[model samples]
Target: MLDLTTGAVLWCALTGLLFTGLWLWYDRRDHARLAALRHRATFHCIRCGNLYAAPRAEEPAPCPKCGHENTRLKF
Candidate 1:
């Protein structure tokens, strides 16, 4: 019952809508994951003022902030 020209247009529209929805969903999910990671406890170097977060409590780590060779205690 549908004309060939109409069918082609419909198919293109549906495909475009599907791709747009997928892209939005992916972007939102990625943003959520980054937000959660930022909530973790990270330390900043007093000398260089760099931000560093460790997975676990360990020895001193170098300050990525100022490129200092010394490790600062993480709280």
Candidate 2:
């Protein structure tokens, strides 16, 4: 009877740990995906009326169609 009780408690603890690990893994993956998306700066060229995205938001990126430097579009 004592052995059976101990086994049940061990199994419950193992299941809880497994769920916690899976939750943490998924949370980290989602955060990384969102972080990558947030780094891309969207731009719109007034000269050629073109819209595009480039890495980093602090600087200007040249328009691919018109070769015009455009500041990052504000939200």
Candidate 3:
């Protein structure tokens, strides 16, 4: 029978809790990073003169209107 009252069980629970906390922290960090990148990116299409916003990862991507390459605005 598996004993839930043993030190092994306690250690396992603690490890699980630690990993869960770490995962949550990293998830929040990634979300913040993505949000910042999204805000930093301002795309402008010279071909169609269309201006839009996109994520940094999607920079140098095609414009939604004319399918032309977009230029990212820098601070």
Candidate 4:
């Protein structure tokens, strides 16, 4: 019957939509994590000899232990 076929099509469409949404959500989460990792900059503290990381590469990062501001390390 036409009604039975319509129900089957509707079910398939909903299932496809659910899967697509999940895939997009996971992909976006992974990309954000990768971007955060790439943006991190390393810093070394002279007062306490602590090594740390900051969100940006150019900005100076304050040491967590000694509160001394340090510039990002060069290669």
Please give each candidate's TM-score: 0.52, 0.76, 0.47, 0.66
- Cα lDDT over the full model 3: 0.83
Query: Over the stretch 6-68, how does candidate 1's per-residue lDDT look in tens digits?
Result: 999999999999999999999999998887675545566777667776433333555656655
The parts of candidate 3 lying over 4 Å away from their true place are 1-5, 39-42, 45-75
Question: Model 2: clashing residue pairs?
Answer: none
Worst 10 residues of 2 by lDDT: 52-61
Model 2 alpha-carbon miss at residue 51, Å: 1.2
Compared with the true structure, model 2 gives a TM-score of 0.76
Candidate 3 residue-wise lDDT, 35-73, digit = tens:
776565788888988988776787787888999987697
Clashing pairs in 3: none
In what order do the candidates fall by TM-score, top score first? Answer: 2, 4, 1, 3
Native-to-model Cα distance after best TM-score fit, residue 72 in candidate 4, in Å = 1.0
Candidate number of the best lDDT: 2
Predict model 2's lDDT versus the native.
Answer: 0.90
Between 2 and 3, whose lDDT is larger? 2
Q: Which 10-residue window in model 1 sums to the lowest lDDT?
A: 54-63
